[model samples]
Target: MVDATIGQGGHSYLFGRALGPQGVVIGFDVDEKAMEKAEERLKTLKCRVILVHSNFSQIADELNNQGIKGADFILADLGVSSPQLGASEFGLSFLEDMPLDMRIDKRIQRSAADIIKYLDEKSLADLIYQYGEDRASRRIARFIVQSRKDFPITTTGRLANVVCRALGNRGKGRSRIHPATRTFQALRIAVNDELENLKALLDSAPEVLKRGGRIAVISFHSLEDRLVKYNFRKNKEENVYEIITKKPLIPTRQEISENRRCRSAKLRIARKISEGD
Candidate 1:
């Protein structure tokens, strides 16, 4: 089994407990802190645990290097963990001010601040619209550009303020979420190259799984869910996969009540198929 986004080993620990001593669970995470925490959490499990401090996009290569031919199961939880969002170093939240560094992996050269500082107005607007699905991207970009001219937008609070000011009262009264939410999400995605990394992982899945092996992906937003949906559907058409969920399985009301952040989660599963099957 492989846990692709093994955030704090919550999923891995549960799965590891069910595995026999001979069973192996290889986990991948780009965040070194997550890997360290996961190692501590999974240490008591009976199964052999191998934690890799790297992106899931490199799963195939890592597995091969470990002399693993194929895996029986692969699981990816695409949502950012609550701890990650709250960690001041990640700079993922607008609720409190933090340095505007949204890179999940510190190895990445560019931060959210770099993107904001360097990207042109039109490009910034396009990035927000394409990645965030924000309709007010132009106004936000204009405001950001104008604000930066006065002083560099170096922190999360300042960026949020700029976005809120751009949309005025409409940002507060009409929306349940903060006005800066979409803009921040856009910047985070860009800083991490998230969509492309997801594409790489999806593309590598069929080759990495053993025959009849299954893969499950839990995505938190429409962009991530849509990618998973289309990839599974396309693989099914090619007889490379058998879609397990006819429609995405969403979180139950009970589950959402227990963990409000999971309300937007959508889980999809698929099994690999060969010519004989």
Candidate 2:
């Protein structure tokens, strides 16, 4: 079994326990902190746990390096972890005045700050529109460009402020979500190249799985969900996959009431279908 994006080993823990003493679990995570935390949690498990401090996009090569041909099960959770969002080091939350880093993988050269500082207004606007699905991307981009001229938008707070001002904040009680939410999401995705990595993972998953192996993906936003949805559908047509969840499975109401963040999550599962099938 392979747990891709094993943030804090939450999913891996259940998988490890289920596999018991006979299974081998390989987990991949780009964040060093998450890897360490998962390692500590998985230490007592009976299965052979191999944690890789790398992106799941490199799953095929990593498995090959371990003398593993294919996995029986693979799972990937595409949502940013709570720790990553809450920690100042990750720079994901606009609620705090943290430095605009937002690189889950420290090895990545460009940070959110670098992206904001370097990209031209048009490119930045396109990124916001494409990644964030924000309609006011042009206005936000113009505001950011203008704001940078004054003192450089260096912190999450400053960027958030700029976005709010650009969008004209709806006072305190009127708005449900932050005005800067979409822009911040756009920056984080751009900084991490998340969609591209997801694409790589989707492409590699089938090749790295044994015939009839199961694969599951949990995506938070429409962008990620749509990608996974269409990819699995296409693979099914090609006889490369058998879609298990014809429609995505979402969190139950009780689950969402307990954890509001899980409200947007959508789970899709598929099984590998060899040519014989």
- Tell me the TM-score of each prediction against the true structure: 0.97, 0.96
Error of 2 at 46 (Å): 0.7
lDDT of 1: 0.92
Q: Return the clash pairs for model 2, or none.
A: none
| Tens digits of per-residue lDDT for model 1, 1-277 | 9999999999999999998798999999998998899999998999999988889999999999999988999999985799999999998889899999998999999999999999999999999999999999999999999999999999999999999999998898867988998999899889999988899999999999999899999998889999999999999999999999999999899999999899889999999996332
For model 2, how does the per-residue alpha-carbon lDDT over 87-108 read when each residue is reduced to its tens digit?
9988888888998889999999
lDDT of 2 at 93: 87
C-alpha lDDT score of every prediction, in listed order: 0.92, 0.90
Alpha carbon lDDT at 71, candidate 1: 91
lDDT for model 2 comes to 0.90
Query: How high is the lDDT of residue 185 in model 1?
Result: 84
Q: Which candidate comes out best when scored by lDDT?
A: 1
> RMSD in angstroms, all models?
1.4, 1.8
